[model samples]
Target: MNRNDTLVPQVFADGFDPARVDRSRYFLSLLDEGRAAGLFSEALFSLRMNELMERLAEQIGLWTNGRSSSVMQETAEALLNNLLYLLDLALSAAPEPRAAAAMLARTPVFPLYEAGMLAARRHLDRCRVYELALKKFEAMVLLPPGPAHFLHGGLRLWLDERDLRFNACEELYVPSSVFGRSRRLRGVAEAEAALAELCERLRSNAAGPV
Candidate 1:
């Protein structure tokens, strides 16, 4: 589904003039806004994915028949964009999160997306994808609250950046004690409290020693 040999740094919308807008960047921005607001719908994801796939297919066919630089570049960028979006959709639709420990034991596709992102190495896309990926897991863990939830590597890095500084492997046994691999987080209130405590510890960590 990804073809990096032909990716460009920017892609415009299906109909928008590239001279006027970078559609790939624009679409990604919208995805960011949607994810942040916890406002995703299967309908929207389906519609957008369909539209992008069609355009990508056309570009691939064109390039296949006639080696067009323009076509190849568009296809490459769009492919990575699609994966990023698809992962977002999956995270949003997780009406169920696996056992918290199960998640920590192995991230589902976080690593895959992170690797594909190397192919998506255009500066702008790079800036956005990791954060988006982490945000997806963040949103997933913060769901109405249920079993003990765990943060995978990407999500853990995200929390750390936001001043939470959890050890992806250890959480310094701090968050591990609070949000460890058990069904400890019985509800949202507890989860929120734990996150608050993590933030406080991060502040202290920042202020003390080294």
Candidate 2:
């Protein structure tokens, strides 16, 4: 039901006015404040998203060109997943995250959906870049969590400049701001470069005092 060109940046919000606000920082800040206020419930967020979808059914139908109900539903479901991913990123970035979450009732779902779509696409390309580099390191192993984790750590740092150094973590971190870059990046050249850098690091690790 969708064209290849229709696959726009998954991070671009449908109605966000970038001239008035920084898309990445704006959602990030609201997410921070909402979490501090004891919001961020997944169930509630899903429920709210459902309600938002119901309201947008007509618009969705128009976009889908009167496709079958099932196709439209599938489209809505995909969009919902994208929205949830966006919220997950925001909450993950907050300090002292609570054990529970509440719905972001005041949060605008439409813009969130748009942002989610954009994020999902950018994340895929970034992942593609990393996966390509990973193939070269399959035989290499390192201490504890192993080489894969270390390689991921490097990519995460490269993706987000706010970070000063590589910090290994269990969760995969995708920076919201990376999708905001003006330059378009496909994974090929980046993967080649990353592989070269990783090979250099491996050699350094294997080297002994002269």
Tens digit per residue, CA lDDT, model 1, 1-210: 232212211322233222432222334444434333333233444444565455455435544564553554655664445554433333323232222112211223444334333332332233244334434544655321221233344334434442111111112222343334433432122333455554454445546798
Q: Count the backbone clashes (under 3 Å) in each candidate.
A: 4, 10
What do the candidate models score in CA lDDT, each in turn?
0.36, 0.41
Q: What is the lDDT of residue 186 in candidate 2?
A: 27
TM-score of each: 0.22, 0.33
Question: Which residue pairs show collisions in model 2?
Answer: 9-118, 10-117, 10-118, 10-119, 11-118, 11-119, 40-101, 40-102, 41-101, 41-102
Candidate 2 residues 1-210, lDDT tens each?
333122222332233222432233334443444334434344434545465566356445654565744454665655443334454443333342221122233335554445444444455455556555454545554222444554457555544432101111113332333222222332223333444544556556557455
Candidate 1 off by > 4 Å:
1-24, 38-40, 66-210
Off by over 4 Å in 2: 1-51, 55-65, 70-83, 90-93, 96-105, 135-210
Worst 10 residues of 1 by lDDT: 163-172
